[model samples]
Target: MDKIKLSKEEYENAVDEIRKFFECERDEDIGNLQGQIMMDFILEKIGPSIYNKAIDDMQKYMTEKIDDMYGYMIP
Candidate 1:
């Protein structure tokens, strides 16, 4: 599968969230450069696993709903 690419808006949102997290969690405000570097690193390294997990969760959710629907028909 191709790597997930965040849109400009999404990337900016993520960077903003990171900036918020550092402020709330560590009481430190990180600048854009640091946030972007961190965000890029996460996108390259951790994003794939997170994306795969989301896909797996969605698949399972659909499968469960389908099975529930089938149960009503089969019974």
Candidate 2:
């Protein structure tokens, strides 16, 4: 599948959407609902395949960073 390239502004907007999704006044309230709604909107805009690939890439990057930090700590 071809990668969808986004401008810096577009990428920032997507990040904002994700942040708004999980940021709520109360964690025990309907925050998750709002988050899910935001996620659905984002997924609809980005498409499922791209969304999944982006998420997977982010996870891999984070894991690698953590591993690198762990390696440095052992020295």
Candidate 3:
């Protein structure tokens, strides 16, 4: 797939919308299904390249959060 470029504003808006959608799920199983649907919608709307980039960015953000939490727990 060709690279799909997004302006900063567009990326922020997409992230906000995705977070809101996930917020509506009541449990982990439902949230996972909702996340998959959200991802499919995003991929369909934005294409693979942009979707993959978003996924990578989110993974990095989550890893940083986990590391921060681990650091807080260590002596």
C-alpha RMSD values across all candidates: 1.7, 12.5, 14.0
Question: Of the candidates numbered 1 and 3, which has the greater lDDT value?
Answer: 1
Off by over 4 Å in 3: 1-46
Off by over 4 Å in 1: none
Q: Model 2 over residues 1-75: C-alpha lDDT tens digits?
A: 345556767666765666654455334333445555665565567676777888999999999999999989955
Q: Ranking by TM-score, best first?
A: 1, 3, 2
Q: Which structure is stronger by TM-score: 1 or 3?
A: 1
Residue pairs with backbone atoms closer than 3 Å in model 1 (clashes): none
Best-performing candidate as measured by TM-score: 1
lDDT per residue as tens, model 1, 19-40: 9999999999999999999999
Question: Candidate 1: global Cα-lDDT?
Answer: 0.93
- In candidate 1, clashing pairs total 0
Global lDDT of each candidate: 0.93, 0.65, 0.67
Ranking by lDDT: 1, 3, 2
Roughly what TM-score does model 2 have, to 2 decimal places? 0.38
The alpha-carbon deviation from the true structure for residue 53 of candidate 3, after best TM-score superposition, in angstroms, is 0.1
